[model samples]
Target: MRILLHICCAPCSLTVVRTLQDMGHEVTGLYYNPNIHPVGEYLRRRDTLRQFQEQMGIKVLYKDNEYDPQIYFKEIAFREANRCFHCYRIRLERTLFIAKRGRFDAYTTSLLYSKFQKHDVIADLGRDLAGGGQVGFFYHDFREGWKEGIEQSKAMGMYRQDYCGCLYSDFERRKKLLSE
Candidate 1:
């Protein structure tokens, strides 16, 4: 099956990509992260992904758009608790739309590989986006390979982000790191 893998970042996608390929699925990396804050950070992640794609010999669908923090902030709007729900909705929705248009058999995301992310929430959003379409959502607990993913990323010299993406999460990461 051909899979449209929504790549959050090169580091997170490292193991996921390899795993998918090992399963004999053709993988195309999609970079559609409007959630990654600050223009510089977004570009950094993009560039890293480009490098990884080249090294892995994978096809890429790059959504070269500027970082729009407002889209995220406005959607979540004071509901700090449910911010991730909206974020997942926006991203997975985009992926599903592309999958429908592109006629891909299935779709998945590197976000699922992150131990820090809300796994169940992401799965819920993915299911909602699919809406019983021909395109199915592939959910794997890639968090099981978290340590190996990080290690492989380090060896590959990928840029590993500290925060989980959104501005609030970035600020929270900074605050937590500072206190520690």
Candidate 2:
């Protein structure tokens, strides 16, 4: 399968990329995250993924370089409670679009590897986005490699973020820190 994996960040992509490649699938990464707020953090994560791509000799398509937080804020402002679903939809829709254009056999995401993310929502969104499309949704519970990915990333000196790439998630992280 020629898979277009939606890479969230370097740490998350490491395991997913490796796992798919090991399964004999040709994996190309798609970096289309518009939800990562605060320009600096976004750049850091993007650059880290680029570095990883270089190290692994993988082909990665960078969808955007401009940081547009207003777009995200506007979409999720009133729907904050279900913000993740919207976020997943936006990214997955873009991925499926690119997958079709790029002639990929299937699509998947590194988000599925994150325990902090809404796995079911992402899976459903991927399936819906791929419906009636030429590319199929490749489902894999990558959470099993979470720990190994984290440790490998640390060993590789990659930048590992604490939150799920949004202002609200940043606030939630801070709240958890204060409570702990």
In terms of TM-score, the best-performing candidate is: 2
Model 2 spans with C-alpha error above 4 angstroms: 176-180
lDDT for each candidate structure? 0.86, 0.88
**Candidate 1, backbone clash total:** 0
Q: What TM-score does prediction 2 earn?
A: 0.93
Residue lDDT tens for model 2, 121-144: 899889988887689999999999
Candidate 2 yields a Cα-based lDDT of 0.88
Candidate 1 lDDT tens digits, 77-156: 88878888888887788888898899999999999998888899898888778878899998888888899999999998
**Weakest 10 consecutive residues, lDDT, candidate 2?**
63-72
